[model samples]
Target: MAEVVEISDPGDPRLADYRDLRDVELRKHLEAEHGLFLAEGAKVVRRAVEAGHDARSFLMAPRWLDGLADVLERSDGPCFVLSEEMIEQVTGFHVHRGALASLRRQQLPPVDDVLAGARSVLVLEDIVDHTNVGAIFRSGAALGFDAVLLAPRCADPLYRRSIKVGMGAVFSTPWTRLPDWYDALPELSRRGFTTVALTLSEDSVPIEEAVAGVGRLALVLGSEGHGLSPRWEASADRRAIIPMAAGIDSLNVAAATAVACYAAARR
Candidate 1:
């Protein structure tokens, strides 16, 4: 049985970890120690607990706790019960789900290790929006990308908003950041990976043609407004695109990522 600590006074020091309405630094600390991030809502918390990560503690409403009794019993950590108002006061925001748990984030496999036996990988450069990051991850997980390579400027996929938008797909997908965006290209090439850039260049080939000749492949999608950087575009063995009949300028990065990821995986 998990210990249920009732928290009435918002000033209680035990609740310090959950304080603040929005503190990115505090969340980042969770990543430093165990790579943990808050999994909001009873459902996401339950899934995280079931996945066997060290669930440090849960700040939950009494009513919500009852529904999670089975999972709570299985948790090896403390459960703090708080009133709706107290939770909001501590978190500094309206927590709609009435329940949130802090779980350890596991270390991802190295880029080299991930690429060793991979058939397809998606490389995202300078994608900053958490929503788009989460959506891309959801699509990537469903579309069958072996792994995702995030550049230095990409949003943290494990952030609460991203995780929620991603529907917990971020938990299963493997991602590692490349220290230097350009430095990693040669490494990919050495592993027999054909780097394909999704761009709107005249010399770029159609999606079908590009995939036909490649074995191990890496598809690169740029940031939302800027698209791929000129240097990154030049890094590709060739460029590719999804044909549009109506002269659409381009797809949203999230939608484009899904199309590109699925196409690469299907090949």
Candidate 2:
């Protein structure tokens, strides 16, 4: 069971993991240095723990305790009970979800291990928005994709914003960063997957046709601002586009991912 420690000081060194969450750069450094990631809300926190992550500590208001009592009972870390105002002051944002947990991060698995038996996969290249990454994971998980592969420059899927937006879908999804961004699609092809990239290239076909009858499919999405790079677009086995209304050329990366995942799920 977790030890309940009521803290009155917002500046306590023991609360380092819960500090300055609004500062993305600072949080990134602190989390990386400590080999940890945060899970926001009772649901995400519970999912992280259920996914076999080790809890470093927990922070919550007195009102949130009963709602997360089972989680506290299962965690061996300290639970710092504080006022709502103190939590906001410490974290630099109102923790609307009423609870937060810090969990130890595991070493990332290799691409081969993540793709061992995947029949349908989502491949992301330089999509750095935490919300988009989280939304993509949620869509892929909900739509039955086998795995996800990220480019080296993609945003951290384990970031607190991502986890919260995805409602902890990252915990259930199998994902890892590709070591070689330039050769990623080619490598997937070598492993017997048909690399279907979402792009606006003139030669691109409809998404349904591109994904149809594929034995093992990898759906590739690109950065929000530029879409797929010329190198990546040309290297894909097939290019596909989601036919949109006459005026709109494309959807937001996350919206596009959900639509694409839906089509791929039935393939």
Candidate 3:
């Protein structure tokens, strides 16, 4: 079982990592310098445990410990037991789920390794919203996509709000952030994967036609409001659009992802 330590003082150095409820700088610093990601709520903490993330510490209400006893038993780290009021004070918000963990981030395998045996993959470009990212993961997992890739501006999948929004699917899905979007498409084609960009351009073929011919495929989804930029049209092997009602121009990015994922899986 993980050792449960009682903490009351907000200024205690032992709780340095968990202190300051609204310290965005601190969170980013921890991620950039320490390579730790925050996993919040019972659901995400459970997922992180199941995914084998190296847990460093837990901050939670004393009563919440019982709910995580099994997870705690497997966690080889300190669990800080605080009162509900103390937790609120520590986090600067009401964390209704009552448990949060700090986990060491694991290194992802090379993109080739991720795509080696995969038939379908989703590539996201500059998806800045955490909610959208989470929704996409839920849809991707349910629709049977093999893995997900994020472009540089995509929100961190391990962010607390994203974990909650994704219902822990972020941990279940295989994901890695690709630094260079320009090289990704060509590299994927060289690996025997056709690249399909999701857009509503005039030249775009119906999604069914694009899905019909591809074997190993990378389905690219762009930012929610802007859609795919002009440069991607020439780079991708095919452009696809989901047909909608007479008046409806397009679905939300997350909704489009669900539809695209379903189409890709059937291919």
Candidate 4:
């Protein structure tokens, strides 16, 4: 069972894990150094704990304790009870969901392990937005894709904003970073998955046609400003584009993932 400790100081060292969340680079380094990730909101925290992530600690106001009592009771870690203002001071945001947990990150399964028995998957290449990464995971999970593969430089799906935006789908979805960016699409092809690159290439076919009749498929999407890298685009087995109105060039990456995943689910 967890012990509840009341803290009045924002400078408390015990609260170190939850500090300065808005500082992206600093948080990344700190989280990496500590092997931890923060899950915000009551539901996301519950999901993270339920998904077998061990909690390092929990921070929340007194009012949130009852709502998360069952979870806290199961944890051996400390629960830091603080005033709302103190929490705001430590975390640098208004935690509307009223609970935040710093949980241990486990080793990600290998690419092959995530791909085993997966018929449909989404491949992301250097997508930098946490929201897009989370949204893509949610779409892929909801629309019947079996897994997700991220390029080495893609945003961390376990980032707090991503986790909140994804509604904890990142915890449920099977995913891992590709070990080799240059041969990622080729490697998928070697595993018998038809690699479909979502881009605006001249030879691109409609998304439906690109995925039609394929038993094993890997749908690849790229970063926000620039699309897929030349190596990835050129190496893909098929190029696909989601048709839009005459004037519009493309949809946002998250929107594109939803549309493509919906089409792939039907295929």
Candidate 5:
């Protein structure tokens, strides 16, 4: 069972894991160094624990205790109870859900492991936005994509903002980064999955036609500003584009993923 400890000082060393969450680079380095990630809100916190992540500690206002009582009771870690103001001071932002948890990150499974038995998967190429990564995971999970694959440069799906935006979908989805970005698509092809690259290339066909009759498929999406690299575009078995009205050439990566996943699910 967890022990509840009341803390008034924002700078207490015990609260170090919960500090300066708004500082992206600092938080990235800190979290990576400690092999931990933060889960915000009661729901995401509970999801993280339920997904088998061990909690290092929990920080919350007194009022949030009851709502998360079951979680705290199940956890053997310490729970720091603080005033809302103190939490805001430590975290550098108002914690609207009034709860935050630092959970240990597990070793990511290899790409082959994540791809085992997967029929439909989403491949992300250099998507740097945590929010977009999270949204893509949520959409892929909801639409029945069996797994997700990320390029070496993609954002961390377990990052706090990504996890929050994904509503913990990152925990449920099977994913891992490709070891070799250059051969990612071809490797998937060798594993019996058709590679469909979503882009605006000259040879691109409609999304539905591109994915049709593919028993196993890997739908690849690119970065925010630039789409897929020329090597990836040319290497794909089929290039696909989502038809749009005038003045709208493309959708945001997340929006595009949702649309493509929906189509892939129905195909």
Candidate 6:
């Protein structure tokens, strides 16, 4: 069983793992330096542990302890119990759901390993927003996509906000970053996945038609502001667009992924 240590000092060195979480750049640096990521809220914390991630440590208010008793029993890391006020002071924001765990980040599987036996996949390019990445992961998991492939520059899907927003779907989904972005689409084609990029080029076809009858499918999405790059738009096996009602031309990238993944699943 995990040892429970009661702490009152917000500046305690033991609380370093839970500090300044609202500062994105600082959290990124610290989490990468420590090779760890955080799981927030009771459900996300439970899911992280259940998915086989090892806890570096846990921070929670006294009220949240009993609810996570089963998780604590399985974890070897110490649980730092604190008042909700002190928890907010240490973490830099109010943790309403009350439980947080800093979990060791495991090595990423190679691209081929993530794609093995994957009939449907999501390919993301330069999506800088953590929320969109999280939402996309959730959509992919809910709709039964096999895996996710991120371009080298995409946002970290394992970030705390991403994990919370995705409701821990990243843990369940197999994903890895592409080593080479320039030839990514061609490589997917070589691996037997028809690369269908969601774009609005003049010749782009409907998403439903683009994915229809394809044996293996890779649904590609791009960034929020600019959409797909010219090179990527042209390199894909096919370009597709969700036909919109008269005024609106497109959806947000996250919303677009859900629709596209839904379409791909039906194929």
Clashes of 1: 2
TM-score of 6: 0.98
Q: Who is ahead in TM-score, 1 or 2?
A: 2
Off by over 4 Å in 5: none
What TM-score quantifies how close candidate 5 is to the native fold?
0.98
Model 3 CA deviation exceeding 4 Å by range: 19-26
* Model 4, span 142-227: residue lDDT tens: 99999999999999999999999999999998999899999989989999999999999999999999999999999999999999
Evaluate model 3: give its TM-score: 0.92
Scored by Cα lDDT, where does model 1 land?
A: 0.81
- Against the true structure, what is each candidate's TM-score? 0.87, 0.98, 0.92, 0.98, 0.98, 0.98
Q: After superposition, which runs of candidate 2 have C-alpha atoms over 4 Å from their true positions?
A: none
Backbone clash count for every predicted candidate, in the order shown: 2, 0, 0, 0, 0, 0
Pull out the clashing pairs in model 2. none
RMSD value for candidate 5: 0.9
CA lDDT of 196 in candidate 4? Answer: 97
The per-model lDDT (C-alpha) reads 0.81, 0.93, 0.82, 0.94, 0.93, 0.94
Q: In candidate 1, what residue range of length 10 has the lowest lDDT sum?
A: 27-36
RMSD of each: 2.6, 1.0, 1.9, 0.9, 0.9, 0.9
In lDDT terms, how accurate is model 4? 0.94
Cα displacement (angstroms), candidate 4, residue 60, comes to 0.6
* C-alpha lDDT (0 to 100) for residue 73 of candidate 2: 92
lDDT of model 2, residue 163 = 95
Better of 3 and 5 by TM-score: 5
Summarize candidate 5's per-residue lDDT along 1-267 as a digit string, tens digits.
789999988999999999899999999999999999999999999999999899999999999999899999999999999999999999999999999999999998998899889999999998999999999999999999999998999999999999999999999989888989998899989999999999998999989999998999999999998989999999999999999887976899899889999999989
